[model samples]
Target chain A: MPAAATEAPTLDSLRRLTRAFRVEILRMIEAAGSGHPGGSLSAIDFLTVLYFRDYLNVDPKNPSDPNRDRFILSKGHCVPALYCVLAHKGFLPVEELRTLRKFGSRLQGHPDRRRLPLIEANTGSLGQGLSIALGLALSAKLDRAPWQVFCMTGDGEIQEGQIWEAAMAAPKFKLGNLTWIVDYNQVQQEGLTKDQMDLAPLKDKLAAFNWHTQEIDGHDLDAIDRALAAARKVTDRPKAIILRTIKGKGVSFMELQTAWHGKAPNKEQADKAVAEIEGGRR
Target chain B: MASATTGATRDAFGEKLAELGAAEPRLVVLDADLGGSTRTTAFMKKFPERRFELGIAEQNMIGAAAGLALGGKIPVATSFACFLTGRLETIRVCVAYNRTNVKLVGTHAGIGIGDDGPSQMALEDVAAMRALPGMTVLQPADRAETRQAVEWMVRHDGPVYLRLTRQNVPEIHEPGYRFEFGKLDPLWPKDPEAEPDLPSLAFAPPNGKPRRQAAILATGGVVSNALEAAKDLQSRGFLARVFNVHTLHPIDAEGVVRAARASQRLVTVEDHNLAGGLGSAVAEALAAAGQATPLVRLGLSDFAESGTTEELYAKYGLSASHIVEAALRNLA
Candidate 1:
């Protein structure tokens, strides 16, 4: 049986893993010649903490086990983060990350579960993943199963009407086993999310929906760990963590830059990004 | 005259779902706030634990239903046909492409819905549902057939869309009706077993000119009109055959080919848009079979207006008289 949240992958090591994920994501996106690196960098810390720190009950072998916890990448534009983390955890071949965005790549521009069975759904048409995860959560609740479902969505992507649709539903179903982590990087593809469309008082909006809401620094591994632990104790309402993170978090030049939301870095920029993460400088 | 004998297909869908709920443990129903309209609430009332009422959110409901299917539950998601089919992107990516075992029930299909106007009428639902890969589209002719198809849908393994009507229709089948996927039900002569091609003799019209034999292929509530038109044409000394096509996607191409061989012309009638629906499917199938038989497509060529079902049918050329007129005009 895989460890569940209280086991291996200590906090120190998870911090190290997050840095490595940042490097891998940048290099992979650069190699693919196209992909969203800003969102990938912004969301990697929470994904690393969730997947590596024994928080999720997953088996690289036998992924379809009925009792396994489900993970849905609602923010699918940043799948490079997920690909790198899954590879490091041995769910996929590490060499496959470079082939992303290529023709016939299992890793398409968006998630295609048929190509990669470990993927729960074909997402990236933003605001769809939460609903898919809600189904898994609702099913587990119906069967009285112990598995919980985790989903991650981008801050700007939540502006889609369907996100609110899924948001309003999960709490009504009293899906306590469901947790949605909002990667509130504050920057969308066009510009800063606040300028594009203000999502101020986002926590209150989610709270009013009857969700157990929390605001945390998304880049902090310790805070992510604590928030996830707290969410597990929620009994009657779904959990929503508004994780405030910086776009292109680990790279100084790319940070808070809207242009980096989708573009792949050149080899020169890729070298600088990898060096920054390696040198332990934000 | 009790309504049960001529009840709506959606009513049959709801009633059969309740019966299937008792028989199938894995069966679950989900609705997008229009359970009352879609007729899924009957099962919801009986098996409340298995029912999920996702209020006013069709996309989420569909996506969730896909997840439920993946999680080993046979989920039936329901809404007004237009609203349910309007969420094509979610269904396309999540359910159809995933090949999840989801039964999508779209009630209040086509202009038969009456007065609710084009927004509610799913005139193009079959067009959208048929466009998806692995999505089986079925629209029953009446109560018995709807019940049988609903029961079969629970047992079928992949994605299926069951289209139903709000308006009550006359029960067309007998008590022991069985729905076979990809098979067409012959209705006009009341002969499901008859080869229907017994009219090989070249018949002359009233003016004494020989013309080709013709057949009407139809589905849903408009089928009764097709039956009437077939009778009228036969009485007028023209060979008329009618087939009620329940399964629209994996349509009985064999039956269509046989009918094409038997008749020189085929008129496909439906209460939907001319594109991507029953007529389009039949045309594609016949063309793909390398058959050059002429065809007259009968259906809504434009958006519908608020009116009675009969009024819409007449104005849109879906009435029995229109079918007869189309047969007289084409079938060469």
Candidate 2:
């Protein structure tokens, strides 16, 4: 039997994981000279807690093992954070992180399942991951497997009509084994999410769709851990966690800035960001 | 009034699927509340535990199918081809992109779906399925072939898109004839030695002389039409060879190139868009082989019109006469 998840992820652990993820992601993007780092940095804590402490049922060596939990990164642009977490968990060599977005690298700008294992689906086009996760969850229910499927979506990507279609579907199907985490960083490539398209009353909207809903600070590992625990307790419906986070959480100048969504940090910007993350870790 | 002999392809698909469920325990069925229309009712009845009835949600149905494949289940998802293709982008991206072993049974493919009109006819499904990487596309010639195709798909690995017709077709292939994926079956002989020269008045080439002629490449219900045209053309002193191209993607490029080289005139017929169906695939193969034969492609031009299957076939110039005319034109 798998260990029961608890509110075990600590703030200190989260801070260290976040800094490590940020530094590695910067290095990856810098090596490749391209990739979306803002969203990856913003969603680091949630991904860290999920992979290292919650949801993921995986052994890095035996990734194709059937009983392991499935994780589908629907918002594929944030692959750097996902790659960092997967490497940290030993899914691949940590050295591969520096090859991000480079030609012939397994770590492409978007996630490709053929190149990586434990990646349930290849997702790049937004708003499709949840549906894939729902499929895996439904299969688990049918097979009577003890595996769960975790899907992470972006706030800007929620604007796609397909996401709502999946949102309404999970509850209707009573897929309690499915959990969806929305990175509500309030910024898109164009501008702030609210400025682009208001998705206010987000909690009620999910509730209306029949999802068991919880809202949390995305960067707060403890809050994310608790929300996931609460979600697991529900067996009647699918769960959705609305994770509130800054677009660029740790870096001062990049925080909440739309322009940083996909831009690689230059030498000076990289130095400043690295110093801040190191300072925070200290 | 529905004729006993004139059953929909969806009905044959369902009947064959029930047999598959009994044969393979891992075989599961999923429907988007269209069990009656898509003809998965028999499978649902026999294997209720293995069946999922997704109420009017094609997107969810696709997702659930992919999920089931991940759990070691061979799921056959049934829906109208139109709804299946238009609504289930996730299925194409997730299930197909991941190369999961799932079979998508798209019923009511092409304009053979009479009276329901353009919205129901899925002329673009072949194009959509072929566009996905690592996807195998199958369009069976008739009921027996549909069953054979389903069995072949179950044993085969990776994603498969099975295009089923809503119109009944005559059984052309004899019993025990093998159905191989990605290999074109030559229904008519091109070489004299390979042709069955029976003592009792064999169907020989016209003028009692073996001559180089065009190869008629087609699939689905149109194979019979193409065969009929080939017979008529043979009577008119033309040795038209007929090839039943069951698989669309990973097409029989070698066979097509060989036929194109020998014949130097290729005519493709199908009950779908002329742009991306069998004709387009054959054209692509010919181009790759640097063999540009005079090819006359016949299929639906654009949007389909509402009518009976026969009327629509004739209206869209996809009948035996149209094929015969195209073959003649290609020869000219």
Candidate 3:
């Protein structure tokens, strides 16, 4: 239990950390018996890089620091991934990850700010985190603070009209301090996103709404780092980084499987999933 | 009851918001593309930077309002009461649970928004806002009360719902009226006589317009009408009085108890529906307090007709004539 963050990890080590994050996410969801695994596994690399790498100006001891960079999980059902990242970063105890979605635990089924002070807002309903992020970003501008606000949206969740509403509003306010990263996992509760309701040519749609749009491989930690850094310097309009992601990213059985979206793997299945995640980095 | 001047609570809200904006730097306003109708344009025009236009996105506007409040600003989010409460889930989580200093101003309340019909009406807003824990519900009776409520709400430091009206209602209180939270303002019969002799009670002439047998509790633009109805009943030798129930939630239970004790029957009138607004609040209070006064909730029982406000009120039995008729029926 180190009080300070460890030394900056190299690309190879970051890849290892992301693999560890995926394993922990699988273990946590398996332990909880009810959790989001597909989205959590898919977004682990981006989250791992943001929190563990040389980015994200957050102090674990001072989660409520007014000037701290803000991250909102708009796809809040994937909080298992966030909980893993927070715990690994000392924002939470790693031992408590198994208590997710349990009775009388801080880790609820969805993101609850009251339950966890580090959470920016309660965002289970989807498509709402971007607007709140814009709000926090706008506040930073108003106060002349240098903090940034980042909101992660699930690909399927963008179908909500409020997402477009925020997409349209960010440019109008010229919210340079805000960045919405889309976890384009291509899988949702019902089925494949393309089959449910197509969000194809998303880059054009985001560009039309006047955002600085970028597309990248979500699993590439270096690409994520570069994209996030580049997006931060745009300072003219709000940025949207479209991270092309596989639904179940790491585990061999779970990878690219939509059925794994919300269901927890059984004990043997979880063991295999963790073994595959841990072995993949080898 | 015809006053020299009439005012829309929304119009006064805009002016007071602008006034407050000039003084309070952290006071921000968000409009969901209804700036013109919601009267947030006044504040927007004055403080463009401070007033954010969310462009027909009530959910986003509400979320942003909560965020801004979290960032140390008083954010007032405005829209048609229907649209604002339509995003009740967002409000339920971001504003109510987070306990941010976000003042949600829902104008065009009830069926009084005229031709726009039920889609634009906020008949169910009171029920929704009141359902949330730690949410303060305040509906102003007139221009004075509206301004006072807005000013007080900006400084109150919590989640509040300030319900305003689209129609022009006559000024009920004096210019210097102060807005009190969770307290009913005495508006009719000045002061009700305490415990009149029930034994010596004389019935009015059975031939003329019957007697008033209840105290009318009302809110919003209907307050003046309830007062007029009470005065009209007074002319017919009925001892009915009216109380302007501005704060619907945390409703002054003492006022309901007093009103119930003063009359044999208690009538509550609002432009809202028959269930879950002023009526439900009053009924809950009286039942909990064990007041056995017969209650009559006067509001639209079914969907409202798409007509002028006056015509709708007449049809829904929320007009002054309906109040008089109900009083007569109750007394009979």
Candidate 4:
């Protein structure tokens, strides 16, 4: 729609935006004194590309635009990342990012559609958001609207039986307008995903179920952009992009660690994580 | 075998939906591959452009319905009652919890879904729908009422759950019987011969206004049984007022309080669990209203056992005889 916002976003621009999203997310989680920063930081690049360069048809000021692309954060624990992107996109004032999880603030622990715009559904319970995304996609097809549905899930959350149920059904319905990106960080709330539950050959499993599958380095902004473009080209079946990523890619202390799954950083840890992200920005 | 009326609530739902689709361009239908059973095939045939078949997936059907509602479409999603609620966490979190105006039509509800056994019967649907904060739960008695319920649900400005039956029931209401959500319709007392119209000797209201007494609050298929029980109670000189409390959630609190105050004795009958159903809603209303009417709550005790609709109704004390016995005991 507006000629795809020309001047192809450069790797430097992508990294800078991702860094900004990570920093803002870390600051918000630190302000709340309790949030899942590891996943948020890990998912920043994927979310950044989707919102800025891919599927979403959003105008930050007009969050309720009837034909806007719909995004569902199935891994709702990583709401800090979404809040950062929404704030950066001007859906909410950038100053409001500090209000994350505060008393009487729109930013709850998970996305609440009633309280926030551009949040299509309420998703805190794992394994349920994909079903909703499928519904939204089906709705778009029925209404003959030209909008796509994007849902991001956690690798650990794949253990849920309902996720497979939804996965199995999406292809059967031929939902080409729907895309599911799994943040395959290989770490769960308890520990390593392999130690907890093995979801290996994830791509093969999705392909077997009739999904157009792609595995990419989640932190590679260019690879994410390419994969999203490739996803749009496949117009007959649903698409699944398995993003290989580190649990906390930018912050060295939290990287690939299970303890940061849902813990907030104290003042000391916050200062180090912020400095790490800000230094990466340069 | 008794020739059953060709009653599959899905048929009424589909026909009414197709009508709504023609009248309102925004009305769309979504099905989870049970189109034939859920009776959405008619709408699918007539409005193929507007019907979405999600192919045996209930979760996706619910999520897609919510998205459609967000995109300025009034989507009605249909599935068997068991799958509709068993796979209901999506509807709870995505649709109702988000306050999306999606209408969930669940067919094959209660023991009436005979022969298919317990897995197909949605005995606990009322509990599941009523648990949501602002959802409107409707259980219509017959085909005509089902049509009326669907129309009301479309006009209603929030999430709704319409419990549909698989068996045909005798038509009770006339063509233009006015229907209102959150209001009870009294089927009996059509004439002086009706039980609720009997002239009793005394026990009138102390303020000289006629005191409404001996009321039965029933919903869904139980309304028919309650009517039968009222007739028998009248023949035995026990006049009882029967109230069809159709809308389970946001229950008729004022009507319930008025009945409790007038009768000083109330009984609730439903084809569901005693907890969080019509009985529980009435009990909560009476409790909040601070009324001390003796209440007899009738429903399945816990888990249900396999049986025909009639056998299960008798076994679970949901038949006309059981209602009459409960009323008699309350009077005693």
Best model per DockQ: 1
**lDDT assessment of candidate 3:** 0.85
How close to the true structure is residue B292 of candidate 2, measured as C-alpha lDDT? 72
Q: What ranking of all candidate models by DockQ puts the best one first?
A: 1, 3, 2, 4
lDDT of 1 by residue, A80-116 (tens): 8988888888999999988898998898888888899
Fnat: each model in turn: 0.71, 0.65, 0.67, 0.70
lDDT of 2 by residue, A4-55 (tens): 3465355576667778888888778877777788899888888887777745
**Listed models, DockQ each:** 0.72, 0.63, 0.63, 0.62
lDDT of each: 0.87, 0.82, 0.85, 0.82
**What are the runs in model 4 whose C-alpha is more than 4 Å off?**
A2-8, B1-10, B191-212, B330-332
Docking class of 1: medium
RMSD of each: 2.6, 3.7, 3.2, 3.6
Candidate 2 vs. true structure, TM-score: 0.92
**Model 2 local distance difference test score:** 0.82
Give the per-residue lDDT of model 2 (tens digit) for B113-143.
Answer: 8899998999888888898888999988877
Candidate 1, residue B44: lDDT: 86
Clashing pairs in 1: A5-A54
Q: By descending TM-score, how would the candidates be arranged?
A: 1, 3, 4, 2
Q: How well is each residue in A1-282 modelled by candidate 4, as lDDT tens digits? A: 431367446666877888878878888888899999889988999988887774577887677887888889999999889988888877888998899899999999998978885677788888888887877787777667888889999999999877887898788778899999999998999999999999998999999999999999999988988898888888899999999999988999899999999999988898898898888742
lDDT of 1 at B163: 94
i-RMSD per candidate, Å: 1.0, 1.7, 1.2, 2.1
